[model samples]
Target chain A: MTTADARESTPSSKAPRTERGRKTLRKLLDAAAIEFGEKGFHEASITGITRRAGTALGSFYTYFDSKDEIFRALVDDLSGKVREAARDALQSELPALETERAALAGFLSFAREHKEIYRIIDECEFVDPQSFRHHYETTARRIHERLEEGMNRGELREGLGEAHAWAIMGMNVFLGLRYAVWSEEAAPEEVAELANSILRDGIAPRSSNKG
Target chain B: MTTADARESTPSSKAPRTERGRKTLRKLLDAAAIEFGEKGFHEASITGITRRAGTALGSFYTYFDSKDEIFRALVDDLSGKVREAARDALQSELPALETERAALAGFLSFAREHKEIYRIIDECEFVDPQSFRHHYETTARRIHERLEEGMNRGELREGLGEAHAWAIMGMNVFLGLRYAVWSEEAAPEEVAELANSILRDGIAPRSSNKG
Candidate 1:
């Protein structure tokens, strides 16, 4: 199954049985994102989340066991959404370099719309260390897989590996933090193209031009 | 003055008068690193930091007025040390790419020795947002300066600028997080070389080898 389908089926014990139940679960996760994002984990309360969702307190326990559980679930939910955003941008076949550029552009747009994502994810380091690590690890792994595919297609260098993926992931993430979350001084397309140029030719002077 | 000298002169009101006082101040900052690193800003207490330093309450007051003050001071101290570490690695003049490699290697070694640096710096985002942003902005500015120097020296391609610096900083920081702080699976030199290769040639296959 695709990542979105997997996300839909995850946190299995609390999986919704009815369409109405799924809507409530979605509402809780969305509300948790805002509550936790604005107030952070320590200051964020389940009551606040429920109030934001306009759902009853009973509806909360019906979906999540506690605040921590929902927070963890929210992180997982967001991670999947990040994947989906990138996936949506890669719906058509494109050259490997263009693929990377599209993915970053998509991420920048998503981050701009969901500015709270940075705070929520960063707080996970203290609030939920395992989830924090998992998010980046999984994201890097996905990037590595894409790099491997690019290599197999003879579009990238032969030796690209986990380190290269980590490098690209870091570049995209920091760019989002600067351009998307911090300020939109430059357009996302411009940012993505600049990063893509680095991936294409690096900062080294071309030998042909040196002479 | 150099960054190190500036670091020494900072938070100056409570500056040490003698060698003994300097030792006491160092003790407090080091202890604060451990306290804030392990327990985080909220759970970390002034007494906890003082006890860890093996200093009395009077010494804590001598340097910092409260936990918040010490945390802010600690962030500044650590940011300065990060610069010093990179500066130390770059004591000798080398090519621009080599400079980048040495800086990454230095950072990885520093992170391994002081794993708490990551937690402490990350926490500053919430506890002291200004310091956190300042730390990254200054670091990026330094990198931008290096890139400009590289371009002027004819060692790097032209058009490299602030975005490129942020990209390189992100790459080094994430690589240190994965390889140094999380695990020492890869040697610092090896990781630095891998990143340097990307800076030099990127992940694109060389045209000569395309056949």
Candidate 2:
């Protein structure tokens, strides 16, 4: 979770200089996520974030000028992590549909581990509308790119575009909310496969086969 | 919009008895939608709602005791309206897949007219967690019931269960947010068709000569 990439993604004007500085920044972002996620923007305070990070109050000011700056940076950080989770799942060259399944599975696992992601991202709609919109728009764009790749490979149907990507993203997001964050009623793979089947063949009944 | 059903759906203890009372209550809820939608729950005030409603302060207290009470009532009111929109579109009998398409089209149009629905419903997650959960769970349950009917009628594939319903619900919600609420870039029918295409044949390439 603590990576140099996380540090680089920080939007603070004063970028960390050394390795220790990067770690401190990472700690602050991680702590900010929890603080904002739990207490929300109105109630969350700078001291609360530093207390959670186990860093001195000065450490917070060194990287972020104010709470709003840190919150914005934390959103960017989480957005990057969401992309990374999908990227990590897409490392292997799988079929178009399997790529989607793997990406959803990665997302479900990530959501289960970091349940606060939903809260923080959701709060962005109120606290920082731009970041909130940017997160989904960016995510949908990434999905649209994958859809194009699938179409070129002749695996997916033609005419799939931005709308289709948004549909897929929506399905994955709600599935994660119900199965991963709310409760572990179904395995991540099972849920992922169920969604994948819909994309593969839909729910239309076969002429000769009966369930 | 002012109907007996609307009044019946109100959770407040003081239900409006006369037509005038009902109209006033409806005004308050409509005004509350705008207020909460723009300012959010925390920042939204009772006076703001009353002022927009063109009702006196005493009228607000007559129907709703506090800002929290009005907010809860507004969520219920919006949820009911959503159901009514779908129900209105479903007057005629159609195939299961077609039924879904009609319902989504209905939702898209409704969302276009009442853009504040998303903001109010999303804020419920923070202000009133139970109501937020209820809104989605209830919507998903309704979708699941429809899938069951489709399965029973041999119109849809068997093994389509709660997960499939959730998938469909998620698709419609996000489609509405992107196409309807954010901007009317695409026609409602077009957005609905893009989603229906997924439910009907999915994104997979079709084989030769398959209906």
What lDDT tens digits, residue by residue, belong to model 1 across residues A70-156?
988888888888888888899999878889999999999999999999999999999899989988998999999999999999888
| Candidate 1 chain B, poorest ten consecutive residues by summed lDDT | B1-10
User: Each model's RMSD to truth, in Å?
Assistant: 2.3, 2.8
Report the lDDT of model 2 for residue B83. Answer: 86
Model 1 reproduced share of reference interface contacts: 0.72
Tell me, by lDDT, which candidate is best.
2
Best by DockQ: 1
Q: Report the lDDT tens digits of candidate 2 across residue range A108-210.
A: 9899999999989988888888888888998999999999999999988899999999999999989988998899999999999999989987888855222
Residue A76, model 2: lDDT of 82
Provide the TM-score for each candidate, comma-separated: 0.95, 0.94
Q: Local error of candidate 1 at A170, Å?
A: 0.8
